[model samples]
Target: MNETFKPGPEAVEIVERESCFRGFYRLDRLRLRHRLFAGGMGPQISRELFVRHDAVCVLPYDPQRDAVVLIEQFRVGAMDKAANPWLLELVAGLIDTDEEPEQVAHREAEEEAGLQLGALWPITGYFPSPGGSDEFVHLYIGRCDSQGAGGVHGLAEEGEDIRVHVWPLEDALQAVKDGRINNAASIIALQWLALNRAEVRGLWV
Candidate 1:
């Protein structure tokens, strides 16, 4: 903890909140005021935030082959900004009320990639876009056999059409560097593995 970092929930005062929309997802408008760093309270501000469920994202890694599993799927939100809206990403799913984060990781691994995970390593968690969204992502590195781990798999009823890919660790990192892997969760997970590969391999192998 740094001494200069002192921001907390206590610093914010919520004056009012209203539900703006509710569907598969949610949106809320909040009227609030926050304590200023230099002196006193700041002016009231109104902001609409995207309310989302916390999700678990796992990078299925095979230490034996030094490879990783990635999934490709269509993203409507990125349709405008991305060269291709169908982007490569990690296996992920929202945490259900009856399940834990690790459970969701394992289930999503099987659902999205058709692979079973072993020896899960908790990496880190973060908010993808705190400015307008309250979506938090729990990241992990799940050990698995990447041999012959490429194919198309997803639950059709859920409107999911996914393509699974197994890439060598070097090539995957290169994808990250070349900006091919653009999603936040996948990028963070891969970069974390890049920084701590040896430690993770030592622990799993």
Candidate 2:
């Protein structure tokens, strides 16, 4: 490891923060200044931040069959980015207040794909967009019995319209290569599985 010094949260100064908008989610404007690499603090600047509950994404992998479960749903953010707004993604949901990420992972898998997960393997946690959002995502690979995992599933109360697909693990990885699996959480989970498939299977055993 490099012996370079790294700054921590104490390095940044928050001059002011206020809510700009709040509805289903929130937008906040912040005036902040941070320590510069050379020596002193940089000039204060304002930036808009998107604030939301942290999220959990679980990729259901069946070591027995070497398959993975995925879901398709419409994402408003992709309206202008992709030809089709519907994206193939992993099972995911925001962590409700007081809800643990493990619980969200299990609940989302069941709600979005009609699959039950057992023995989850933590993949990673990250900020999907650190520059604009404080939203952090926890990623996991859950072991499942994909004997007959397929079809449409999701809660009607939340207006969720999800279609489930069970594919050979290789095919799912191919989707990432082909740009079909475009979401950050899904891509990260799938790539992690690809690199550690055998190791994950060993853990299940």
Q: State each model's CA lDDT, in order.
A: 0.91, 0.90
Give me the runs in candidate 1 sitting further than 4 Å from their true place: 1-6
Q: What is the TM-score of each candidate against the true structure?
A: 0.95, 0.95
- Model 1 residue 185 lDDT score: 87
Error of 2 at 5 (Å): 7.3
Writing each residue's lDDT as its tens digit, candidate 1 over 1-205 gives 3345368998899999999999978999999998777757789999999999999999999998889999999999999998899999999999757899999999999999999999899998898899999999999999999887878999999999999999989999999999999988888889999999999888877
Query: After aligning candidate 2 to the native by TM-score, how far in Å is the CA of 99 from where it should be?
Result: 1.3
Residue 93's lDDT within candidate 1 is 96
Model 2 lDDT-worst window of ten: 1-10
- Model 1 alpha-carbon miss at residue 3, Å: 11
Q: Write the per-residue lDDT of candidate 2 for residues 142-205, one digit (tens) a residue.
A: 9999988888899999999999888999999898999988889888898888889888888785
Clashing pairs in 1: none
